[model samples]
Every structure is written in structure tokens, then in C-alpha cells.
Target: MEGAPQGTGYVVNLDEKLGRIDEHWKPRVVAQMNDYQFKLVKICGDFVWHSHADTDETFFVIDGEVRIDLRGGPVVIRAGELFVVPKGVEHKPYAEHEASIMLIEPCGVLNTGDARNERTAQNDMWL
Candidate 1:
């Protein structure tokens, strides 16, 4: 995102970008830093329980709210809040209504983490 081509700009209007998505649980990359990628995703219902084996996953709630059910207890994140699931910590996220979120993780990291299946989203899908 920093190395824009000549006259290109790095600033992205989040509202405009988020409007382009029509599916749940699918993340579209918006920016990059080093080997990490920042993605925008809209989620609803429940997500698969999984864990990242090698890197921590950061979640920033942009709108609505989400309940992250961890092995111990649930961590609810509302809009304007952020949470980080440590590496290898098994957890599942749920939302009663649609929630807009931004994920900061290593490039190519799978959304379903170690539990790869039909629900595993395609990685590095840029918006």
C-alpha cells in the first residue's frame, strides 16, 4: 500500500470498499505492511472453530459487534474495539447481525486457520 505506482494514493475509503462485498466470512485485502495484510470482511452467524499455528490474528471491529468464543470464555468486541487471538489459541467467532471487521495477519494466512475445509476462504483475494 505504501509503494503506490507513481501518482496512485494509499488512502482507501473504508465505506466504499466495504460496500463492494456481498458475502460473509470472505476477506478482501485492502492494504499491506511488510508480510502482513489488512483485510476487510463482513461476517454474520457463526464461524468455524480454528487456530493459527504460526501467527496471531488481530480483529478490529468497524461496525456492529462480535462474540469470540474462546476455550475459556467469550470475548465480545463492539464497533471501535479490537482484539487479538494469540497464536494457536482455538476459538470461534459469532455475530447476531452483520459485523464489519478488519483482520491483520500474515499474508496468505487462511481464514479458517488450521481447520481447512469447504469453509476455508481463498487467501490473498485483493479488493
Candidate 2:
């Protein structure tokens, strides 16, 4: 099995990889090793309120601001901020303009959480 990178991997150009993302609200897996996977998602507007039943989701804001509504306690994640939504806590993500985010989660995380919606993707798109 391939091991995780010890440090930043200089071989892959992130800008070139980011160029492959063309769809909004869709997440594409960019890197994976062991039980972890890295995904890039471009988002705008309000997303459906939901939560993962099994695994926690971590969001790292790459660019722009994203507001995560946690029902009673909401937080605004700006560029360079990282937030983790604990498993089974319902939350909604919104952005006024296009925002780029990176997600760190175990493989097989469903973006839409428990409730299936039009945003639920059938397969993990790689970009």
C-alpha cells in the first residue's frame, strides 16, 4: 500500500489540478491514502442542511468566505480558516460568491449527508 506523504508533495501542481473543477456543488477527490481522502469543492449560494451520520467532515477554506449554519450556533469560515463539523450535527453551508474549499474525510463520505437530494452525486468525480 502507498503511504501518506510525509510533507507537502511538490510533484503535483495544485493550480493545474484546480483547473479541472468545472461544476458547482460537486466534490472531486484529488488525493487519497490509507483511510483518508482529500476533496475539492466549489460552492455558491445555500446548500441543503444535513449531516453525516457516521463521520465528521472537515472544511478548509481556500478562497472566499463560507458561512456554516449549525442551527443554533453558526460560524463564518474565511480564507485560511479550518472548521470541523462533528458527525451527526446538521449544518448548512452558504457563500455569497464562489468559494473554494478542501475537505478532509474518510473515504466514502456523502456530500449531501442523510437526506438525498439533487445535489447528491452518484460517483466521486476526480479532478
The best candidate in terms of TM-score: 1
TM-score of 1: 0.92
Write the residue-wise lDDT of candidate 1 on 73-112 in tens digits.
9999999999999999999999999999999999889999
As for candidate 2, its clashing pairs are: none
Off by over 4 Å in 2: 1-10
**Which ten residues in a row are the worst by lDDT in model 2?**
1-10
Writing each residue's lDDT as its tens digit, candidate 2 over 69-111 gives: 9989889999999999999999999999999999889887888
Where model 1 places Cα greater than 4 Å from the true spot, the runs are 1-9
Local accuracy by lDDT, each model: 0.90, 0.82
Query: lDDT at 39 for candidate 2?
Result: 81
**Positional deviation of 24 in candidate 2, in angstroms?**
0.7
